[model samples]
Target: MEKDRLVRFVGKVMEESGFKVYKDFKTSRYIIDIYGVLPTIVGDMGVVVACKNYDEHWEVGLDVLKEMEMIGKTLKASKIVVITTSYFTNSASNYAGRRNIKLIDKDGLVTIAKKFSKKENEIYETNVIDENEDSETYIPSTKSSKGPSIFHAGKRSLSKSGRSKSVGRNLNLGNFMQGFKGIMSNTVALIIIVLLLSSLITYIIGLFNKNTALIGVSKILSSAILSYGLVFYADRDPNVVLTKGTIVFFVSMIIYVVLIVLL
Candidate 1:
């Protein structure tokens, strides 16, 4: 199966097993392969599962375990599981056993797939986070205030420095949108307002100037001034300005399209 679909299958299995699951689960630290919960003898165990599809034998090693261990502690996950189509090395297995991390080889994955297939009908489908969605996201599977465990996991492909950056970065902005309107904030909101005004000004100038290049320049200048005003008022950093500005431009274009069609 394709990697995306493979992860989704893992998610479905988690659902069937009666665990709340999120596929492509992102966290402040790193992207989780699969995050879910399972009822256990002790308590509800938050699970962080990493899935790998490789042509050759994929060994879960000490490095992978250390990453998981750190992430598990960060999220308070009760268990960490790595599922791969490739076979595990002896050292890898030994390292996992010592840390209480579960390693599932090709055969093990098949077993879980078979076991969960029985409850295939009731699998809880969710809006899985896409890889390119953003650098930071940790959307919960459930909105209930009670569910607290937010498991995080990652890939060996990520550089050690990259993982550290993710772990260190703040995720407040990524998770703070109350609604579409709420997204319109600081320089982002200002850009859209100026863009609309610029559109009107450009249309008016077109009646005389007739130079498309000149009109485009005017639009850019107008947007920059407005954006600068917002940054000045909000004290937003350049990164925030750029990120929010991109969002505003696209969303405003869509809104303009809809308005034009309606008229």
Candidate 2:
């Protein structure tokens, strides 16, 4: 199965199992393929799911389980389930067993497909798995249910489509604001802003006082600030700093000479 379809299939399975499912659930640090919550008498249990649509030969590794474990901890998930079209490595299986994480290999996937076929009256081509078969098999479902399309899973109460739309808009706005804040907070960006503002303010003050000296001082300050910025950029990429700094140096010198002659 394709990765996207596998995610949706897993989500549908979760929904069928009495859990509220969310597709492409985004967290602060990670994007969960399928997030589910199963409510019980005690409390709601969070389930973090990862879907891997690998070839039969390619086995899911220990690193994938470790990553899922970290994601589960971040989401405070009660259960971590990994469903893969392929099998799992021995180390991965051992780690999952120790961590109490549920791993569904190709055999388990076939079993799930068979169950869904029986329950939903859908036909699956890979009902029986042959040990000797080398080619890949897909379980196609005709079920119209697309599962949950929302990025977030909330209370069990059914919310209107308008609410989901609003939530999506809010999330987009929030992400844009966050990105803006990050850019503004960057040290290099702040330095550039300061250079522009200081140059403008100095020019204004010089004009008001009718003092050429203040304007000269402003040019000097701007050059110093530019040099500092160049030095900072040099730490990141020296080639960029060299090219830009050389051009800026000549340009500043020409501008300063013109100002001296004109003033």
Candidate 3:
């Protein structure tokens, strides 16, 4: 019952992604739930899908996946996509590899479903995929480019917004470094000046206790300046920025501030 729901869910995702769903197709040995077109194909080519609930199994065994692979190969499936509620074991992965079968676990199923769904939804291009172009994108081969854009909305080109919208993105170690480089390039001198100015302001606040409000406001400005400056410098630099380093720097700075207060 639950497995049927999961299968339906996967089907819905696949449908949304623009793949045509032909469900409940019987093969020689097994009944396949969802068979759909790959993102790169138009007209006739399609991929096979085998959906499983996996209530009892913790992992997909090699035998089950291999059987499905054989069936798919017999059906002339370009790829055998197995969507299971359970993940595949290491042995299962190896088995699939030996047979050139593609496996999608629960998590992987969701991802592939989403990806295919997104491709299917290119309302802009409803024509058959160009064989040469689509083949290059869909098939798993070393000849493909590192960042080949296919099954995208239209005109496989990167937009400026896509390229430049890294400001608020959650970055990894390498990405953080890239962002830090950009940040540094944009605001290095400004940060240094702000740091010096903040130090001077701190010195002034210490000496002048006359106007508490004025001192408080100055302190806030100094802190903001210092913080913004540092962040800007880190982001603008075209290189020399690490995500971990930035996080550590801020965390340490916060600790240092707390220590200063205690002292």
Candidate 4:
């Protein structure tokens, strides 16, 4: 049988014997081969079986046997059955005998499976943590009744380091509405603002004068500034400024400078 079919068969046997089975039981990173909760029905007991599909005559390794033994004890299982198509090594059999784990070799599996084909009664209980509780029920170790220990200090310190880290987060979220409005507005006044700023800065740098270079640079800067305003407006709408947008702007700026200097 396929692994899943074999597991299903084992689980069916367990259920018939009156046990609650939990398949793919994750104790840690790896899932247990077959972890099940057996009902406490008088003489009929539940089991956890680490099922293996190896060929006959192959011996079950001691380490594999030990790991399953530990998991069985941890889960409070009455018995752990290493159900394999293969027989157990002498050391593995001795260990299982001492630990009280039942070995279900290929032949034993079919026999035992046929025996536990009836369901039994089981008791189930669960624990839950209460979220809403007064001080009478659950209290923090800290003596202060004001609030949580972490927020014990009276005021939030707005120091240089704190503000520096907080500024980026606050700007991204708190100023979102203001930034969105500024980016969307098509007031030509905003375009004029960018144009005037760029032109005045270039002029102050002595990069522009009464010559053709001055006029040419001014026009180029003015065009870029105007485009930036349009880009900002488009950004507010569904109009996207892709990754290429910044590259295009930078390249245009470089070309404009080279044209003024050479041509």
Candidate 5:
């Protein structure tokens, strides 16, 4: 079969399976042969598909699967599928299994084609697949037994919102913990923490003593130190660190003057 024909066939199958199918869907990085979306009560599930029209001697490899996986991720698709006129390599099959990508070989294609013809009340003939070959479709195993619910609108909404809030909190906590761990391991970050603490203490003492000059000096010093520490810690050029430090010092002095005048 030709590549265009294969893509059309796959799009038809997806449409029959209740997907809103789009052919030759274009993304920022790729032009997907087929894209489908299955709308449910909870949310819309997207599927990214690629079609390969290879001869029997040629087989799809792991690289193709990896590319399809990337396209799926870029589109945030719920499923990834690669349908081919030939078979797949062992490595490709294994990788697809691990990545939850669906691989449909020539035999599987024949099976779906037959079904599609039967549905359309038309005769479909193809010499691409062997008649004796066993038809097997590979569907990745999913943990959920009960799929998305269409009923219980109120209850589902409540449960979905609760899960979203829980996930958000857990993600925030995880990010905070990771950032704290990174800061603890970095020497420059430690120095910056110390400088900030010392500056706060000095500012408090200066305020108690009514020493405006001391407060202004402490603020300027801390701001410059903080900026320099950040630039150095980020592994920037020395020249960039110096430039940013000087700019931050002057900016801090200007802010101090404006604040003093306003107060």
Candidate 6:
């Protein structure tokens, strides 16, 4: 029957993804056409396959997918994979997604199969995956950072390049904002610590020295403090340098004036 050829075809494709693939695999309840073990970074994940080669341009529907889902439940499979020669209907895909079933049509299978020009034993011997790393850079036993895709190859969604190398990656505005905020916070913290420490030292010096001497010292430090903020801010962007400099200048001046009057 057509189903037999489809099972064999799916088995061949699964082999490329570093699976020990077998056709007509039997479980406790029913006979699964294909079953395989996918070695991943987290652990070995089980894949149960349902292969269909339709005679017509039939859209594999949700009803068929539900059967695969039920079968997957019994087998405790990580992925319930449905591979078809014909394309899937929209409803079928939606339903499969809801059930967490992976769907692969004729084109996806062929593309995946072609990538496996290497012999199955060679792949088994060579590939090794380690702690949650990029599957693209995986050697022996690796899994994608995201979940597994329908194909054995990494499935970076919205990226048309499938297994092909891409020139760029998506920019994340949220991450950029978070990093910027952290830098600003650290800069402000450093300024606070430095200014506070300087004030404490000035206070101790004032306690020991005469008012005239303290006033002279304060004046010199005040000029330096004012210029420090300006110079610190001058190089970078519109960072918190201006604010830091202003605070340092004003605080030093207030301390300087207070000592001159009180002493």
Candidate 6 C-alpha lDDT tens digits along 56-170: 4887998888888788767766567888888899999777655557798878766655544433433343333234557576443122121112443332433323322311121
Candidate 1 regions off by >4 Å? Answer: 39-43, 118-263
How does each model score on TM-score?
0.43, 0.47, 0.41, 0.40, 0.47, 0.45
Which residue pairs clash within candidate 2? none
Off by over 4 Å in 5: 122-263
Which residue pairs overlap in candidate 6's backbone?
A: 127-140, 128-139, 128-140, 128-141, 129-140, 129-141, 129-142
Q: Residue-wise lDDT of candidate 3 within 1-263, one digit each (tens)?
A: 38778767666665544456778877767777877653331223455777778864677787777677667657756456776777888998876665435677777655655555544453223333334346544443221111211112222324323322331131122233433433333333334444466658867786867586776567556656465545544333223234433443454456546766999
The lDDT values for all models are 0.57, 0.63, 0.53, 0.52, 0.62, 0.57
Give the residue spans of candidate 4 off by over 4 A: 41-46, 113-263
RMSD of candidate 1 to the truth, in angstroms, is 19.5
Runs off by more than 4 Å, candidate 3: 38-43, 110-263
Candidate 4 structure lDDT? 0.52
What lDDT does model 2 reach? Answer: 0.63
How many clashes does the backbone of model 2 have? 0
Model 4 over residues 1-263: C-alpha lDDT tens digits? 56687787777655433346778778754577676553221222335678788777667889878888677657655456787866778898777665546687777766554333311110011011223445476433211111111101122224423433443343333234323333333334344455555556667656535576776566666656555555544342223333323433455566556755997
**Window of ten residues with lowest summed lDDT in model 2:** 148-157
Q: Worst lDDT window (10 residues) for model 5? A: 144-153
Supply every candidate's count of residue pairs whose N, Cα or C atoms clash at under 3 angstroms: 0, 0, 19, 3, 0, 7
Off by over 4 Å in 2: 122-263
User: Could you give me the TM-score of model 5 versus the true structure?
Assistant: 0.47
Task: Please identify which of the two predictions, 3 or 5, would achieve the higher TM-score against the true structure.
Answer: 5
Task: Report the lDDT of model 2 for residue 66.
Answer: 86
Candidate 6 ranges beyond 4 A from true positions: 117-263
Global Cα lDDT for candidate 3? 0.53
